[model samples]
Target: MGWAVARFDFSWGDAEYHQETLENLKAAIKSTKKLCAVMLDTVGPELQVVNKSEKAITLKADDKVILTPNQGQEATSEVLPINFAGLSKAVKQGDTIFIGQYLFTGSETTSVWLEVDEVKSEDVVCVIKNSATLAGSLFTLHASQIHIDLPTLSNEDKQAIMTWGVQNKIDFISLSYTRHAEDVREAREFLSKLGDLSQTQIFAKIENVEGLTHFDEILQEADGIILSRGNLGIDLPPEKVFLFQKSAVYKCNMAGKPAVVTRVVDSMTDNLRPTRAEATDVANAVLDGCDAILLGAETLRGLYPIETISTIGKICAEAEKVSNQDQYFKKTVKYVGEPMSHLESIASSAVRAAIKVKATVIICFTSSGRAARLIAKYRPTMPVLSVVIPRLKTNQLKWSFTGAFEARQSLIVRGLFPLLADPRHPAESTNATNESVLKVALDHGKASGVIKSHDRVVVCQKVGDASVVKIIELED
Candidate 1:
């Protein structure tokens, strides 16, 4: 007699809060399992100054502003209370200050741009380069040979990682404003201390010049990279943003890491549908071979969050249908490190085998999610279903996909679906055997209409001390 097979199940109630937006989100994920991810935004402990005045503060050809370290301080027409301490010590007379690419050069400068005429311990006076306004916007100080040392992870970020992340078993944690490889390492170390490194994967947000400069190094340490264009546009030249995003996504693929293009639909925040430009932007990212397209403000705070996700998913699926599969795989293949190369070879073989045999699906039983990601990196035509063990990893993978190794690192990669594999009969071993788990995966796929009787299935799993790949003919 054949052994009893386990199955994978997802409860809408336990998935997340019950709401129209969330329900729609779950349906979207179910439809686009391999290409979608849900990101929960969090505000870090870092504080910035905001204008207390409701009105915009316009600066003409010349305007003097005060930089005070007063919290909740009111702003006047001439004095702007900035809460950054040591600002006067860090900036000099010729230093340039930028508010969303608006330049304000120092007074000792030669150009007619905004010049800092005077620098006090707590205040700096500047002459505006042109008529500009500071209406509660984020600003950055740019100076030659100037370095700003900020915390890698803020206190609030730490608290959230330990509290919300641990409690919910989130699949991936995206570190915002990551400046260096050290930042990624620091975040991993923090997660390690919190006992989350094994289950929660980390994604580095490459948004600024500094992060982009050290992207390769950061990519080596991070599970994936999120190309955040909104923040990149703030500091980088507008014309170079798209080029950088495309280049970054290509590089990540070459490195065998998932790369996500983000903030493609900023205009959909208020509109019921995406603008023509926004729709085109998303389709272009998909054509660029991005593993995933991320929606930020448009899906989180936007009036039509469900519509935004639904629209983006449809666009991505359509783009994928028309994309050149052979070219996509060729672009992603390049020289990689030892273990990665080995795993990539395994995944590549599975894809080839499935295609040759006309398999319906590729089923992977993963403890750390590597087996699943390796398969996804190949961008196979058949849907890859990951039977992730450890109930925590299952729940976490729902958000993206994680354990002994970094969890759910391949959550957003193309053509990968993660499911929790639960055995009805609990065994003593911490890890389940490959044969038993494969049975579970097959059973779940059939019950979910992903597989039919006599369907060909490609199975990939890591057995004790060795990796196993097999082709199985299912029966009723």
Candidate 2:
């Protein structure tokens, strides 16, 4: 079964080649059909130099900076700053910098363009080392960035992120530390202008009191919500975090949007194990009907990243066993009873017919996974096999339902053609070319091969310009 898991802290700096790492991650997701989206945290945008002294730094482009602090401290190395000067050889006022995997620009301030080449790597090592310590709390296993600020969101930054997301076929965009409804609107409009807002959803993080008050409005505009309880607890009374979490989850569920509960469920970033309280916290969040969960330091920089994911998965599975699945399913299913178009009506009818005929499998050929998803939305008892050409669609579908399966185009078309075309097929009448496809489906045990001569099978496909739904019977 395809299940969506979002990789929260997928850093390009940590990997050798950022683009290659992303491609490999995409490939892994495609193979497993499990990873729903890669939520890349814009490290530079969120990174701020809290303390900078008047020190000249002289370093050539691509030169490495190694910081060795005074008196028995560890040394850390950061890649030399990449700027317009390094890339294009000539720096400009509004040009952006693409260094390694990070992007910086002078749009926010001209001072950003000033070269600090004279400052030796060791002279400013104290500042660099201490900045890590200052930012350490935010990197903790349960830490969420609450009051963090981005230097600025320029059009170039927005377009860059959006283009990458669209090209990667990401299902959701999680705006870190979302504060207002306008922020949600701005993201929506940007994606809309890019003409890639169909199935791509935008999730807003509510991390403060002001965001909490306007949560409903934000939910109305956004596709989903993430409750960053750690930073949220900073603004409100610590004891109130649980209450606020419940409220956010309830609101998201009410609005039919997915909500993710994040924070230190396992305060074992440095340690190899989770505390008893952390286990309970994870179990409680699952009981609260969170569609997904996010792990920060635990999964990123933790000593036991794999273990953290496994433990959380176990807790969620166990909680789901005892939780009210029926209630959750009923609440989450959103169907517009009245079909708005011919294709939609046909899709809806095919699902009903499949259910009525007690089909063992609902096989669908789709380019976008839309038809299969629509059928899955009805919560049919049968498994749905979604055949598509795009690997991203296959991966994205994993989050939608547990019974959905995906097959490549070659497997669905070429490999199955002979079985589908056999004349003595019992799965359905061999009248149409696509009906033969059902023979291959039945041969593979996706559908029952032995059916009474009068038994009906519903076939749905888009032939040329028209979407057709035909009910066929077994040929004796």
Candidate 3:
């Protein structure tokens, strides 16, 4: 299903709560005989409105509001307590501050828009529009075309990653509200310092103008890219979010990184079915060649979680039917620099050989999961079985981290099925030969029912110091 990647959001709950939920989710996946990867989303830094009491405040259009910074009191209709020191610095007269989660497409009944009328030493006075109820909440603050001086990585975010992520060995860590390349760099560097527990991959979430401005540099540091259209709408004009998504996805493709689009099926959170617009949005994103579609509240707290997954999955499949992979492949390859690296050359050749032969599947053995990522960049129609051949950790216990972590990391890429090699299998002995390794991979395919007898499969592997692509028909 489109539920291959499961996200545990620190944005909503603490890591401890997420850990328990994760275990339960894993058990569910195990019971259903399904595969899913984990993505731990950092809460990052945010501005929120605090209230003196847990009660909703009624506000109408033309209502006067005062936004005070960090005074330790709850918000009222006349005064809103925002928990940020630099709020006044970024917001000024005539500036618009939108509240609520994903309020880009402001509904007359729900979205809250405020125009700053005056900036004072203690607070900023504003006027409200689009009549909506205000409440004691952790709402997102926005100042379009302006960069708020929020920390690149908040302490809470660091605590989550360094503690929960390291303990569980997360597959992907999506940096929230990433503003620049430095944000990604800092997170990765922190991860690396955690010794062998740093097997995680970082995905930069581009949601604002600052991130969009530094997209090139961020892409270089991030293992993948997440186009957060909801937040993008809040940062730019809602109508222009599509332009950002299209451009960002295309750029990620050319750069050979997986691009994941989020919030494509948000309406399913409360409704029994996705709206027609949401359905079309999913199809269009798939057609745009996104590697995956990420759901937020749809699966986190939505009532029709299963149905949403099923519906989006079907939409993605239908979109793929009419997609021009051949055209996309050419465009992707043409951007590669001359004298391609050894790994790139092998990856491109393998993809072309698979397509030309019309192979049923493409199987490759990878140590770092790089081979699978490169093949995914080519967007092959057939599934690519990326068998993760793990490395021996030098630690005292010698427990391998690459096998499972790398496998999970590869699953988010489109058309790639990452499977960890059965370390206990006799054929996977430390001193095994290439033939034995190939035998184990083929046996895995057979056991998983991915390959049938007499099926033609493309095999990409290394021989001594060189890589080769071979086409072979499985024997009965």
lDDT of 2 by residue, 1-476 (tens): 12244543333243334456578767886796442445544322332221132133233333434222232323223432221111222222232211110111111221121222333433321112111111111111111223323322345446546666566555556776577788778777776676444455667877667678788888999767888765575457668889989988877655545678877554667677778888888888868867677876565567887777777878876775677644544444443434345655665567677766765455665554556545544434445555432222234535222112222111111101111223233222224645555565545542335344555556666666667666665555
lDDT of each: 0.64, 0.50, 0.81
* 1-476: candidate 1 lDDT, tens digit per residue: 00011000111112244234445655765686523333433332222445656456666666565556664677655665664676667777876554321122211221123457778767777667666655534333343223345575776677656765665455677787777999889888887777544456678877678888898899999988888676576457779888898888878877768787777776677788777988899889888878777665565457887787788889887888898876666555534434545678788778778878989999887766777887887777778997766533244445332231232444566777766655442211435454576677777788879899898998887666666778999877
Give lDDT tens digits, candidate 3, residues 262-347: 88776788888888998998999988889998887677778898898899889989999899988888877888867998888899
The segments of candidate 2 whose C-alpha lies over 4 angstroms from its true place after superposition are 1-3, 6-20, 30-36, 42-156, 162-169, 195-199, 329-476
Find the candidate with the highest lDDT and give its number: 3
Model 1 TM-score, 2 decimals: 0.75
For candidate 3, list the clashing residue pairs, or say none.
51-74, 51-75, 52-74
Worst 10-residue lDDT window, candidate 1: 1-10
lDDT of 3 at 58: 71
Best-to-worst order by TM-score is: 3, 1, 2
